[model samples]
Target chain A: MLNSYSSADKVLLAVDCIIFGFDHEGLKILLIKRDFEPEKGKWSLMGGFLRKDEVLDSAAIRILDNYTGLQDIYMEQLYTYSEINRDPVERTISVAYYALINIENHNAELTQNYHAQWFSVAQAPKLIFDHDSMVEHAIRRLRYRTSIKPVGFELLPEKFTMRQLLELYEAILSKELDKRNFISKINSLDILVKLEEKDMMSSRKGSYLYTFDKEKYDAKLLNDFVLNL
Target chain B: MLNSYSSADKVLLAVDCIIFGFDHEGLKILLIKRDFEPEKGKWSLMGGFLRKDEVLDSAAIRILDNYTGLQDIYMEQLYTYSEINRDPVERTISVAYYALINIENHNAELTQNYHAQWFSVAQAPKLIFDHDSMVEHAIRRLRYRTSIKPVGFELLPEKFTMRQLLELYEAILSKELDKRNFISKINSLDILVKLEEKDMMSSRKGSYLYTFDKEKYDAKLLNDFVLNL
Candidate 1:
């Protein structure tokens, strides 16, 4: 039966990662300067060809680990770019993935070795191929996913201040949300555990810290809870 | 530069479509009996291999047209499945697309010629390969997409009564909805032009007909509106 597919066309398969991070600066994407390619020296998303034995998920994870030296990141398959001329060198269909990683957790040496840097999504430089369009689609998916799931937590530290949480949401949403409304909405979700500890990073009066109640979050996943702004 | 990619392994690419339809019955999916080797005579999705000169979107559209003889249907690329042993015959990565179509509009003769049948999503038969999983994923996506966009209109007629619209939502969500609440929520969207004409199908008094205001729906697409039950 394998012989039946012999006459079918074969094409190169590649996986691209749009690694998003959030911190005091804003939402940022990890990009590497391509050392070898048809478009060498251009900034592009960290990517590689899919190995024969690996599945798409494993391929995406492998690519991310190769550059970030990070594991167990929250990643999703975004979309596939299959324009006949998307790749100038070959007819490669690239499956894109968006990963949410804690900005502070990645290995600095690995990034430095690969000439990788994080740029604020808005200030991202020109990317090779259709990578700019990939980034745009990823941002849209991130926004839509954040509204339905508590995925924004992936970009934040385990213990974070309400101000940090608000900032993270604002960054992902790319908008300024009213503090009171935001706090009230978060409170209504009842999935946050307000800690007695405070973080004195921003003001003389420290803001209270909070952690996501994973148990509650997991339960909420079974229901239709829309985090409307 | 093209020679640089010669070392990379190539794989066969295929596109499978989960064609969804709705009529007076309920939410349904189009399934076809396999007519070739490997999965001969077993139920499968409408699928085909990608041609060297075509893109993924074009491949999907072509496959759908070949099976259904319908063009310009509402389709979305759902996901890519790439397990090592997913295709027993060869190493093939299948990209799944879900299409919404009006059941009454499809070519009846074409469907019969292709051995195609529409089964209620809940009662769909056991399909070959990972097709059952593909159908499950498509339904989940359809539920999510219908909530954010007015895509349910694609499964309905150009002019339909409020009863038909309510039934469509009921079938998609697979749950009963409060009639007054559903109508009020849809009315608030203000993307439906209610016609003075009536359809006497459900009741003798006749129900008012309504058509989707495309201009208004397009504008609504720019905003974040959740049509919650």
Candidate 2:
């Protein structure tokens, strides 16, 4: 049965992950130092060639877990790059998946063991072989996805201050949005639960903390509504 | 050099086109009857295996031209379907692309030669090999793309009435929209040129024909604005 596809050309398939993390510094992307050649020791996305028996989604999850030691992260298939020479040694088509992980939750020991480090999106180093373009595309997708669905919360702590949410949006959009307008728009969505607790570390007068209402957020995702901030 | 990637798995790559066309009856999709083994004689999306030397974009264009004899149609890469059994015979990953063409512009001879037929989106057949899912995804993408960009114009004739435009949206969305609200929203975009001539086929009063202003539409596409109805 395998011989039936002999007349057809077969190409190597790879999955690359763009892991996005957010912290006090703003949006950051996880990068790895390539441990093998063609571009050994250079910065590139954490990736692996797909095994013959593996599905694309599983291959992506496996790659993410190998680098971050995290599971069930918010990952989405961004785009497929098929430039003939995208892989220097072969005609490989790479499907890029972007994942949003809370910076505080990733396994630090595993990250260091794999030489994975987080760099501020604005200050990311030059990446190898279309990885830079992949990162740029991921950011654009993150911005668009954040506007429609509350996926940015994946990059933040479980309980976060309004200032943190605003900063997350500002960083994703790469713009300084009006605080009042941002708050008003988010409030209108009614998918955040205000808590009595406050984050006292930021200032003498602490800011109130809030958490996402998953049920409401999930319901809102079903309807087509735009959070134009 | 190619032997270096021998250990990596190679999979058959295919391109499936969800060709969308719009006529007086509303949005339709072009489907073809498969001619070869592995689901032969079944109605399926117009597709072909990607050649080794071709990029995905060029492969999609070639497939579209082969089936419809149309050139430069507005095409977009929708998504890649990689289920292990998507193709019963092998592990073939298919990149799905959706193209919008003027229904009247396609070559009738070519379509007939290939036994291609356009079915209304609402009444499309149960296609072969996860193609039904592909069609559904294409429609969802078309709705989203039409909202943000004026790509719906590609499905309509060069000159059409406001009624035709409204019906196109209504069909793509599979719902009736308030005419007044639809017109007001579209007019606000200011990307249409109201012409002196009228399309009198639908009504005796002869509704005025309108053509899209390419420069304005292209400029508006660069901005982040939604034409929500």
Candidate 3:
């Protein structure tokens, strides 16, 4: 172990977070303007260098918090970007993390200070390095995650309408599902509670709003649940 | 990128390959003996340092070839393990690549020279650093992959039987699938071509062997083929 600990071959490691959020519009990703050189002024995902003592996941969370001022957001390590010259300056291996945070959860001033803005996945500007691919991969992962688990709750507000849930899924999956079948399948799962309060925003006879039952959701996760529609 | 790049912040980046193969018994992973290291004589994943000019994917292939006498195998970048001290020797960030190769198609002796052997994922020895987690994650990825793609062909000989395909999936996924349903699903997907020859080794009534239709597979990949059972 001591011999392998050579100073000759050490390299830099970085953590870049792609924070995803969903609002009435669609799926959006958090981007921060690069305040430092070589890609200074260019838009990039929220990122930071890994510290000497932080785990990759912890470092990712810390970065997400440092800039956005949020906590306990759902984040996943998507992939490692390791092209030789991915960073023009040096060989830095960046582990990309995709996070799901409520858009209203963070401070607006922090976002402005960091020059961070939310952009729809499709509307995002040309990103630095393999970030476009990173975001692409993260979206795929998000779709997969949503299909398997009750992950729609992560992006949406605490309570949401069935239409909102469907829209969120549609945005993540980038496809349309059979409306009746989608509603039926989700209802059959029995993990969503129909809330009495309904916001008559999207329909004349507004659709019944629903919230994910965490107790049931956790139980189903222990077993398994599939949202194929 | 200039401010982001830290040549002084050099760290060790290692490529660990989770070499997967399938045989009569089940799915197996290639392991190697450490001949020169502080942990010499111990079992480890086949790995090496990232070259200055190589991409992570190429580095994975290079490391696998250097130790296994294998090339042109189906290898995918699985995940990066980056707990700061996970590498006992230094701050090493390991990009794990999961390789699916045919067990019967490789040079066992070349791997044997370096004391490399194939072990069932469950029975593999305790690996150094975060390799244990890497193997676990790779297996999870393998399960997810088996459901969506007909990649089991990569682990089998050029020609195989439906029974073998079912067994491979069952073994990799660690679950039982209804033979009838599995066969029907495989047939509907149109990824396998029934061979004129028969394999009499595993059954009293010789099983009709099949080979993967690579052309059809390539075409089918144009649309994401979801295998439902």
Best by lDDT: 1
Q: Each prediction's DockQ?
A: 0.41, 0.39, 0.32
TM-score of chain A of 3: 0.85
- Worst 10-residue stretch by lDDT in candidate 1 chain A? A220-229
TM-score for candidate 2:
0.89
Candidate 1 — what's its lDDT?
0.81
In terms of lDDT, the poorest run of 10 residues in model 1 chain B is: B220-229
Model 2 clash pairs are: none
Off by over 4 Å in 2: A1-4, A107-111, A193-201, A213-223, A226-229, B1-4, B107-111, B188-202, B211-229
As a TM-score, model 3 comes out at 0.85
Ranking by lDDT: 1, 2, 3
Sort the candidates on DockQ, descending order. Answer: 1, 2, 3
Question: For model 1, what TM-score is found for chain B?
Answer: 0.90
Candidate 1 lDDT at B37 equals 85
- The deviation in Å at residue B200 for candidate 2 is 4.4
Candidate 2 per-residue lDDT, tens place, B1-229, comes to: 1123668888999989898887767888888878778777889888887888989999998887786576777678888889888898888999998876767777554555566888888888889999999988988877766655555555677898888888877777777878987888778778899999988887999999999998887774322452110
lDDT of 2 at B164: 85
